[model samples]
Target chain A: AQSVTQPDIHITVSEGASLELRCNYSYGATPYLFWYVQSPGQGLQLLLKYFSGDTLVQGIKGFEAEFKRSQSSFNLRKPSVHWSDAAEYFCAVGAVAGYALNFGKGTSLLVTP
Target chain B: NAGVTQTPKFRVLKTGQSMTLLCAQDMNHEYMYWYRQDPGMGLRLIHYSVGEGTTAKGEVPDGYNVSRLKKQNFLLGLESAAPSQTSVYFCATAEQGRNQPQHFGDGTRLSIL
Candidate 1:
């Protein structure tokens, strides 16, 4: 069965600090990877996705993710996190042209100035 | 623009109560999905629809029923609610493409007592 794992349950970072959210997946083949962010009382927004071609994919809101095929991981990163960047981050994986995705447990990010 | 919308932003229910969560999208998307978010569980797909009048089960479809009678609407029903069913429900939509990312709506918070 395909599954996504996010090791960190919570992460706290000071404003302007860099951020890294780890994600690992177990799938028979390379899957489409995605990163999403959810704010308080809000729906989730897609930060980025990795389908093909580039391993390092850039996304909205100054976010980026690298898909490592060898490690079966798609990690999200940001150079400097703002207070507004504080939100719950989720990692997901799905088959090519698949209908649904398998999501991780999510990592709650807290930005403090 | 209302990309996607889920009605009943908040609700409380006792065991065995039945309620339907409605999801509507105006983007003329061919794909609509329902997911449930829980503490330490990120988001799990409950049901999805590929187009009008077509519904399918997702990863965690148990205890939930769904319908997609109209092209822009998807409905999730909990026939007999349970405490374990308490979760924040989200609706998302995507164009019928191979690598399109989904757009989400503000989630509906449901608490089952």
Candidate 2:
């Protein structure tokens, strides 16, 4: 069984500040990792994903995540935060050829001016 | 392309009542999934289909039943509603292969009184 853990339940950052959200996964083999964001009352939108390539993967909305096998982590990072970047973010892991995804408990980001 | 669309964006059901949620995709995807999102609980997969006429249980499938009779449609049914089942349900679709990203619907907010 695969599982994901997000250490932070809520985070607050000021505009123009750097931000990083931690994500860790427990899986047997090389896992497919993904980041998703959800606004209030809306469905989740895919931010980025890491399959098997460069350690650093860029995503939409000026976000990126680096996969670190040694740390079992795929933390999402942004150079500077914007007010509109506030949302609930989730990290997920899935097995190869598997149709299901195991998701973390999510981290709610709050960007303040 | 309308991507993925779910019907009845909001619904309120009483305990013991039954309801079905419909999901349609225009992306010609071969895989579709049903997931529920609760506060701090990211998204948990309830059921999924690899293709038409095939359904499989996901991480959380106890109170949900699913069917995929058509390649572009997936239906999630709640036999008997419960307060514990009040959450946001999202439907998503993806192509058949590794590293493919899943497209999500706007989600249906369901509340059981």
Candidate 3:
């Protein structure tokens, strides 16, 4: 069985400040990792995905995440956040041959002016 | 292009009431899933379909039934609504293969009183 853990439940950051959300997963093999963002009253949108290749993957909205195998972590980072970036973010992991995904509890981000 | 679309964006049902949530996708994907989102809990899979006429239980598959009569449609039914079932429901679809990303719908906010 696979599971995901997001250490942060809520985070507040000022506009133009850097932000990082922690995510950890427990999987047996190389896992397919993904980051999704959800705005208020909207569906989730794919931020980025890491299947294989570069350790660091860039996503839409200037967000990026690095896959650290040794630490079993895939944290999402943004150099600077905007006021419109206030949303909930989730990290998910899928098996190489599986048909479903396991998602973390999610981190709610607040961008203040 | 409209991706995954879930019908009845919002619904309020009473206890013991039965209703069905419809999920339709135009991506021609091979896999579809139903999930529920609650406060402080990430999305938990309720049921999923690998293809037409095939359904399988997921992480949290209680008090719910699912059917996939067409490859583009997946229906989630609640035989008896309960307060615990009041949450946002999401539908997602993905192509058949490893490392594929799942696209999500805007979600349906179902409140059971």
Tens digit per residue, CA lDDT, model 2, A8-89: 9999999999999999999878889999998887888999999898999999999999999999999999999999999999
After superposition, which runs of candidate 2 have C-alpha atoms over 4 Å from their true positions?
none
Local error of candidate 1 at residue B52 (angstroms) = 1.1
Arrange candidates by lDDT, highest first: which order? 3, 2, 1
Model 1: CA > 4 A from native: A96-98
**What TM-score does prediction 2 earn?**
0.97
Interface RMSD of each: 1.6, 1.4, 1.4
Check candidate 1 and list the clashing pairs: none
Model 2, B1-113: lDDT tens digits are 79999999999999999999999999999999999988877888888999999998887899899999999999999999999999999999998876787889999999999
Question: So what's the TM-score on candidate 3?
Answer: 0.97
Cand 2, B chain, TM: 0.98
Error of 3 at B13 (Å): 0.9
The sequence of per-residue lDDT tens digits that candidate 1 reaches over residues B33-66 is 8999988888988888888999888878999999
DockQ of each: 0.71, 0.74, 0.74
Between candidates 1 and 2, which one is better according to lDDT?
2
Per-residue lDDT tens digits of candidate 3, residues A2-44?
7889999999999999999999999888888999999999988
Q: For all candidates listed, what's the TM-score of chain B alone?
A: 0.97, 0.98, 0.98
